[model samples]
Target chain A: MSGASLAIPDRLRLLRGANNEGVLAVVLLALIVAMSIANPAFFTLPTAFSILRSSIVPLIFALGVLMVIISGGIDVSFAAIAVFAAYTTVRALQSGTPDLGLIGAFALALLIGASLGVINGFLIAKFRLPTLIVTLGTQGIFKGALLTYVGSRYIADLPASMAQVSTTNLFEVSTPTGSAYLHILVVPAVLLAIGLAWVLRSTMFGRSIYAIGGDVEAARRAGIRVMRTQVAVYVIAGTMAAAGGMIYVIMGRSASPQILVGSELDIIAAVVLGGASIFGGRGSVLGTTLGVILVQVIYNSLILAGVPSAWQRTAVGVLLIIGVGIQAVASRRSSRASVIDETYQKQEVPA
Target chain B: MKLADPETKPLSRLNDSVDAGWTRLLGLGRIEGGVRRMLILVVVAFAVFAALKPSIFLSGTNLRNIALNSPEIGVIAIAMMLAMLTGGIDLSLVAMANLSAITMSTMFTAVAAGDPALAEQLFPVILLAGIAVGVLGGVINGLLISGLGITPILATLGSMQIYNGIAVAWTGGKTLYGSPSALTAIGSSTVAGIPILFYVFVLVAVAIGVVVTRTPLGLRIQLQGANPTAARYSGIASRKILLSTYVLTGLLSGIAGVLFIARNPTASADYGASYVLLVIVIAVLGGTNPNGGFATVLGVVLATLTLQIVSSGFTAMRLSAYQYAIAQGLILVAAMAFEQVRWRRRRRSRKPAVQPG
Candidate 1:
């Protein structure tokens, strides 16, 4: 943010953009070093792969959350969207089209997820209602509808496509403790992250999202379709959440409606940790990826460090507060300049 | 859609603040249009359900059951309303309540040691300790938001995790029994077919009603939520008021904790996970604004009762528990959407969206 005023070179400005990632990487490294000194088992290849495997689910979910946050809205209903889309898709495939295969499964999941995303998008963009409230209501409705209309029972009998992915590990290593297997989904997750960074950095839709977050009226005045862009952002979030759910099912070889609905807070914490502003306007894929990994590490490693696993909740809360607090304070400190600009712009308007 | 907002006219907003301030100084609370609407909804719901199942829905046992379940959620809804009145919310209230209840429940076991005689004497002190836990938890949330400028939702979200963690860790993920017999008796006892616990909820609601409408703190909260900038310009200490608002929420949660343990034999971390949705629904249905600055206690109370009836009716009607979530979510969404309709109509007509009787 300070780079805006400085006579910094282009490369240096890019480095400034990576400041959040840099800090997170440092914290993560320090934590890893400390954990290694405390328990040698923590820094092993097996542990690394285990953490990586677990991260795929939250990372996908976090990417979508990162999108909504950048557009300056919150979606607490992603968990509901995830389970609702995934479980319904599984049930749909199992009932009739088991032959649709993996591609069909993903296509079906994305469609279902996107359709639901349309609800959030429509309500938010059309009514201009607060995103948090809309999502909270939908969270209940989606989860309830899933249990009421669809079956609440877990389905372990997955389609050949989903079950096959679970077994399609890139590599498995046998350690004294257990075998560590990296899932095939990790590559896609990385690809998605890179693709998202490109889109958010270079695409008009992505820049419009940032503009909307920064100032909706200003964006509208600048010929950015604010409402339409807001709707699209939520749609993207929904589709991503659905993809996350399918990935989760593919990894576990099961579709359980109840297992993933409560994990939104942790994912949100990770997203915020990665440098996305909760109030909106700015975020990065790299920062979010680091955040997801770091949060997952804290959640998984606390128990290894002799702290009770239950304190993972506390860790998430603390990380979220610290992460949000840093940005909030910095923004507040720099708000004076924006206040002057706002007045200057106001004077130009024909009110 | 954006142009429909009434907030565009600064001159009108100035009149609103000045008018509300004068009304508040006179100690006469402004009756928001939402309270009337919620009251109507409550009546309509009760009438519809009663007409549908006259024998079962209006039965003494069913009525008592509804009353029994109303207090815990009602108390939490009030906490949520106070936060909403400031355009903030306390998601951590439930976690804080659980922590408080667990604190008391475990302490009861420690002090009583299976002796009912000693349990009676130690109950009051132990209960105070539980409330103190909630108060302390609220203090942490207050300090985080009002002191450090964290957003209320994120701040409470964090506090919720921390509080829930402590409760879960302290309970070791197990349900602990042995609350004081006095609490159990109060929980189980009834007054004219209504649970004594329901009266406690009513008492809390009424007390809060007075505090919010009559007290200087209440006026400050209204002003702060209405416009933080205006409040600050008027010399109202925004931080202090925000701190007290959360603290009040905490106190309500603490009291709620006592009632929770009184009703149940045990306290655990995961109790009432569903209440999060129901509580928010009640607060919103009660006409509590999500943007802060407006709420009504009686409206929240009515909403709680209305939901309790809907829940009990669901059981009587042989519906699944999950359906209630849909009903609640639909109710909230419908209410918000209804607000939008009225707002648009009023904006289009350039007049208050008055409904004819």
Candidate 2:
């Protein structure tokens, strides 16, 4: 090959190594601009707030899954966990028991989610089974149990306080078309993302997660409690899934048995789009947050563009493939570069 | 050069040991092991179902119904077995099947609407087109996975959505009817009291089993899944093997789709959505290794029958449809967990023995 032609792969490899998030951001910006151009109303403040509000639950889920994925595992059953948690909490609230405060309800939901996560973690870590398959089985069991016990009822009769919490806004801004309000849950969602980002960046446990994901045997040799860390990762993922479900119920004013079923694809696509490698050991809360936003924006924009909602799943699927394709190409190039570097260093060392 | 060769010898030996360890850990070469376990489960399920509702569960008509229903999911499960044997999964099988059925049914309906006699003559052509849709779907999946290097799960997941979306868009989520008599006969008609669909399932399963076990291509697939790097070094075309496995799955799925429409006499974009999980469950329960390298077609066939019995048994016992999902999930988890335990025990027992020469 000519020198100039060879330089093209090198340049592409360089781009892949360093600019994954940068590329995603560019794509997001282009999509926003395109949507704004197609529908002038898209860039309005109200629509922006609406998109953010809608993104909160999925963002929560994406953050959880991002961590799990980075730790070399996948959790498809989070949707089921969310359903079970949401259903139980909604049922308890609707049963007219002595008012357990909002905290109690949140605790109940989180506890259930974490417990389910523990079961998943234990099975996967102990049995050394594939995470995808384990979670796939659990996903079915959880949904089936819910259906059997709960009978597919929609729990719309939430406590007055919980319903009020949904409408309770932190701030309201008037726009040309309408006013927009940031709901109360938005603060917690943002805080969770920030807290998780901090933990992933700063904590010893978080570093161990990355280490294990990068090379499990190495991590084990280095005395990282691989099993414990894995269980913790699933627990965190489960908790976030539960939190997302609760948010969905509170903000949407209804909890149904079917809530979040088959929505794992959206959550996963968002994380992957945000620059998380499905193979693990790479991802961030910030990237996942942006990914969630980009996905929601695309989804909302599609509806605004009058594309039927059925096509949205197709769009997400395409996005997933593209995102994964980019990651695969980048990682392959980087590995190849390192291999070449190792060979070059060996040659120079003998001289 | 002699010194370097000596240095590399130990490393190669270590690699060989690691390979052996994995095969032994998963009991990969023990094809008969899964078959025996599945056979026991099938017998137990039959006994339990018969005990619960002898009149309905053991009835000739109910037995025939189970046989009829088993093929649709069984055929897909066989396809899934091939995919899993190569250490990949095709989540798009159900979607491909539905899309193919929809395409075939739509074409048939349009033709019949225009000229009933001509539609009758072209019925076989329409069925072939449906099978073609499945093959096309498979080829697309194979390219995305083998060519682009996307993981099987993500690649098929995307294809599943795309294929399903196309079906939905084409049908506007409406069910299409009017299958030709000949097409329906393939599903509903029987020879010597045995359903035609069962024969098709058996034929596909046996053909695949023979190809995978008795042929060089099958050996290549096993080697590729067992150790891809070694397989590559040994001159196996990894991409070609992967591509062919997915294409074969797609073809099987297409056949299943055609049979699906043949039996139901209607095609819907969303048909057999639930079978996605069911087929995976069947494949896994049948002892196909999710991590690849080892699979038994007979195991899958037995597992399919076992599941069909449990399903119709539940109906006989008047259990809610929700119970069926619960049982399926439980059985899948239990089977996998049992396999893991058995493998671990075998590994532990083998560890104490002297290394084989």
Candidate 3:
């Protein structure tokens, strides 16, 4: 096994190790400076805080998708899952369920999301279906169910307590230009990112995710519980999506069945841009966070630059192509280098 | 060899017997098993619908409605089948269609406004140009996938967005209407009470079927998809094959778009956003292997009719459109699952019958 691993060229390994985050950091810094120079107001604390605040929902979704990508699968149904979970919570609150406070609503959302995840997990793990096709089906089913059961109506009559929970400011800073506030949701979002990052770095389950993604047959031979790990990854994704949904409803003070329809692309683009490979086995919490921030910054700067909103989709599409193109080239080069190294090592061993 | 051992022989024979029983129960051996199952399903759905709405379901107008509605989807579904046959998918099909339709219709509207006589003469040109634009879209996708090495899904996904954006920007998100009567006739007119659109679909389907079964290009595509490394080592140009498949898909989808505007006489950037998933369902339901290398034009045709019947049935039954979506999703999942199970069973059955080493 050790000899097999040594087939990878050291230079390629080193480059892969530093690739995504380093490029992103430089690009992010350049964009920030450029934006600030173009519009001095963009550099202000209030603007920065607003950008951070708007990123919370997508950040949560991105973290979940990052885990899915790292585990060698993809889930576009998370947005639908989030919508279902949020609608359930709002409907529960609107029903005037006594003692079903914000915490209870949140718990309910998580439970519903987890159950849906379990269905996705069972089908993909047991039957060995492609995650993309399976999720595409489930996305339709979930969205259809939402439409049939909940209609297209928005839920606005939420408990005042829920609104307060979302609006509760963690801290505020007053500057000469203006004041900036941080919502309470940011704390949980940051903590979740940090905790997941730690898990990926230090835990056996986390290591197994990488192994499985790197090579399923090898991972199985190494005694990794592939099915269990896959299910766990999806469940975690579902739970996180639910949390994101809760935050969305709280922030907006309403829930619509159509919420987050077609926004999964944005989440996926952010994760891919941050350094995560869609093929799996490569990603990090830190990289994903930066990806989320970078996507937000690009979106913000485009708006500030007075570009049409429709062009924003074009920009995101272009960014996705470029980012994925670079990753593909890098991976291809690395794989080719490894092949050459393997042959060279074999020749040297005989000599 | 393991077969020389008397003790192992009984176990192997018993395993074979059990596998044979399961395979028999599942109807797993035949290549046409999927078609048989789909035919049965179609029969059952037709019977149920006919029973519920005896007058309307069996009426000529309703039948024509099904015929008219299915070809647009049928044309695109065939293209989707081609893409899937190459072990790639074109998520940008609908986007390509809309973009090309917008371009053609926009050109038509402008030309007609300035010179109606020129517009009449250029109608065919405009239609051809729309299809050419679709081919251009496919060229872009082929370049992205084969030239740049992006995965088909991601490549097409990105292109889907880009094409959609361009369409939106081009028309400012407005609908382009009023194509010439000659153009509309291709979509709406019928000879001897049969829709020309249906005839076009059948003709295209038969042509594609013949080409796929008989032509060298089709053979190369099948070979590339079945095993690209083997195909490449055998001197086939895998990249060129892939590029051609996508281009073919774009051409078909472009034709579908033209027909769409011919019938509706309107082209919009946002038109047929829902068809993306629906076409995938139809292709998969038709037994075009999602992983590629195996497809049937006949299967696609049958599947289109089956779905069209169900859709029209649902409409006559007054069920909501969401119900149709639900049915499509369920059908896609069930069809794929059935294929997976059949594959696994076939693999298992093949194992024991192999000569022991």
Candidate 4:
């Protein structure tokens, strides 16, 4: 599998292989070029940084969704988990728990998220209830509970550590037009992505994830611990969601219980558009990253491209349907079979 | 609660089609286990609420409000349940309802052109337009899923976004207030002490339920969901069934849309955004198998009543809607959990004998 052991043509072939990343890369490049032609400011370093800045939380959340999707399940409750966990931590800190440093607060958020995710895993793995229904139910339950029992108001004043962290900059550039700033916030998102990519690519646990997603019964037959893998998948998903929520709050220097209330479909759409299948068993971190960037660019730069924001949702939806429609047709061509046969075959080959 | 009461004229007179359909479903003697359980839950919820607030909870006005509020969610739930019955879900039905409602409301607004009196006269045309939009939306969903081979979830999710976006763009994300006066009258008025829309809902639900249990299309839908491979070998056209499944659900949405604009008097892109999950909860609580192939009309009907009572009971006790939301979630998870545990125990009990053998 090492690149060093392969010939030049083999390396090229590998680079141009079965993933959606290559197609996504080309589309992203074309969009960027088009946007630049439409508006010169769109190509600037400042614009790039701003796009990168705005996409941070969504990128984090998309990774979690990508994992869950690859594991043959879906998680709509991540948004709920994210806000609930982050809000709980922020509320506890606001309610007079002495400075439990930023690390402490983060750990608490992750812990709360993991515990909540355990509930999802338990119901799903033990009961085999449909993931969509379970998550949907919990989404309401988590948000409803937070608003009723916990505080619903925004906390603009945070603990000193969180307050200071929001202002910390990794670097900044001055220009005649607009300044380009890279906040320290980029580090965590980058680190988390790298860590997740490595775990998903190199670890046995990662392989188990792919296995289970490909076929749960087959994975069990092949000696993988399907239940344990599934539980861990949800836990990791919850923790990442919590991280996304915390990132969102810290970036804005304010925490609200209602943050990210209805953003699940958007994130899931991004994951699927990245070449992940809703039926499960195939996705790549690289594809997801590009998918996030593609969706973010379209969403952020529509105005620059001379489109009104009112049409943004329509644009995204059309693009998604067109994108997935192509994949569906291509798969059908490869196997002349009925609907049931098609679904069954997809789980087997995963491409 | 006058839910089953016949204070007005005979219910059969409302829709002849529904009356014919009823003959097919009413003859079944075996009660599904899930339906029986759901009925118990409904009765329990009703009894508890009636006992707690005998004065106001069971009052005619409050009971009337429950019946009035029930149809919108109830009709939409039927659509959701039908989709799930075929092993798919239409996440866009809520959006479909909105789009169709918008189409209907826009017609009323455009035709009337400030003549509220004239808008009242174009009722039948406007109602048909609303349902037509729903059918159009469903056709698109069907094409994507069955024609293009896209999975139903992705297909519906994408369509939901598109439909919702179009509605938002058209209305600039604001409420386009103005339904036909006739529709508004239907929404607000009661006939012989019962809401007219309630009659529509019951008629529609019973008609569809009968068709689901009695017709070839209904049996084929269940067969496909129950075992797609077997259905395929049996020469059932999965594509046609899937398409018809969505189309039928769409037709229901159109009906719900007419009811929606009538009830709300305004059409908007983002109305009832929260109802998606609640609809799914209702469908599942009614014993619609999320994995597909099995569902019950009586069960779903009772489950809707149960939740409405529980939600209305919270109001009567001065409790917040959020608490009721939590209860909705708990009821679902707890029910599934109990089902899972009982099955696990049964399987465990059988394991010892198999090991010895």
**Candidate 2 chain A weakest ten by summed lDDT:** A13-22
Where model 4 places Cα greater than 4 Å from the true spot, the runs are A1-13, A337-351, B1-27, B114-116, B343-357
Per-residue CA lDDT of model 3 for B248-276, tens digit only, reads: 88888788888788778899988987788
Alpha carbon lDDT of residue B97, candidate 2? 95
Model 3 chain B poorest ten-residue lDDT run? B26-35
- Please give the RMSD to the true structure for each candidate, in Å: 8.1, 8.2, 7.4, 8.5
Candidates 1 onward: DockQ, in order: 0.57, 0.46, 0.46, 0.68
Predictions in order: chain A TM-score:
0.89, 0.91, 0.92, 0.92
- B1-357 in candidate 4: lDDT tens per residue? 658558344654666657766765675655787888898898898899899998889999889888988898888898898889988898999999999999988888887886767778878888998999999999999989899988888889899999999999899999988887777888889999999989988998899899899999999999988999999999999999999999988898888888888888998999999877888999999989887899987777777878888988889888888889889999988777776677789999999989965
Model 1 chain A is weakest, by summed lDDT over 10 consecutive residues, at A10-19
Backbone clash pairs for candidate 4 read none
Clashing residue pairs in all predictions, respectively, total: 2, 0, 0, 0
Query: How accurate locally is residue A190 in candidate 1, as Cα lDDT from 0 to 100?
Result: 93
Which lDDT tens digits does candidate 2 get at residues A157-190?
7877677788798899998788888777889999
By DockQ, is 1 or 3 better? 1
Worst-scoring 10-residue span by lDDT in model 2 chain B: B25-34
TM-score of 1: 0.90
Error of 1 at A242 (Å): 1.0
lDDT of 4 by residue, A1-351 (tens): 888999998887676545667878889999999988888888888888888888889999999999999999999999999999999999999888997999999999999999989988987897888798789888888988999998789888888888898888889998777788988888888898898889989999998988888899999999999999999999999999999999888888898987898989999999999998787888988888888899889987887767778888788889899989989897887666667687888889966
DockQ of 3: 0.46
Question: Which lDDT tens digits does candidate 1 get at residues A103-132?
Answer: 888898999899899999998898888888
